[model samples]
Target: MKHKYAESDGTTRHVWDVERIWKLAEDLEPFEIHIEEIRGLDSVTWFYNGDEPTVRSVSRHAGRILNADTSLPPILTEDFRVFDGMHRIARHLMEGTSRILVKKFSTNPEPDLIEKL
Candidate 1:
């Protein structure tokens, strides 16, 4: 099957094959409650700065992040967050990856990042 472009929003309503998508989600290994996307911008703004978003530098590329076999340390703690996959999860934020899937842990949340994807 071809990789499809999703809205990056949590609403996967328009999708035609629910079972297939669900299976794809399963292929992701352990599906967790990814709430970051639903929580929106202000919630994650502090986590994402400019140059330091994606932990990898321009020369490193996404390949490095994917290639690293080590376990990633948590970024979003009580004080800070990680962008870079190799470094802290808060180190890398170079577009395309801002919309992340997180396990929802809050009852109430804020608006989605209208300015971003």
Candidate 2:
């Protein structure tokens, strides 16, 4: 899966091997975390281009957020950076859910590819 992080220099695009990450964490037990505990919640900007979201982009994300399956737990890093399921989290927040299930890696995994742009 592709993930992006904004840095001081520019946006860094991280390509992760989702299957591998899932294999590493799938057997581990999932736990519940308060929604406020996830720091990524504060920095969610769906637009990676640093521009205001267009109508199409907003509609796309809205559809995703609405359709997200809350039954599936989100995946997170050791320090709680989201590895997947931000849309699900958004769905939970919209529903006024205080906590959600998550699977976390014991250690962070290096991305398959990192492009600084």
RMSD in order of candidates:
15.7, 3.0
Error of 2 at 106 (Å): 1.8
Worst 10 residues of 1 by lDDT: 75-84
Q: What do the candidate models score in CA lDDT, each in turn?
A: 0.31, 0.78
| Model 2 regions more than 4 Å off | 1-14, 50-52, 115-117
**How much is the lDDT of residue 10 in candidate 2?**
50
Worst 10 residues of 2 by lDDT: 1-10
lDDT of 1: 0.31
Per lDDT, the best of the predicted structures is 2
The parts of candidate 1 lying over 4 Å away from their true place are 1-57, 70-73, 83-117
Top TM-score prediction, candidate number:
2
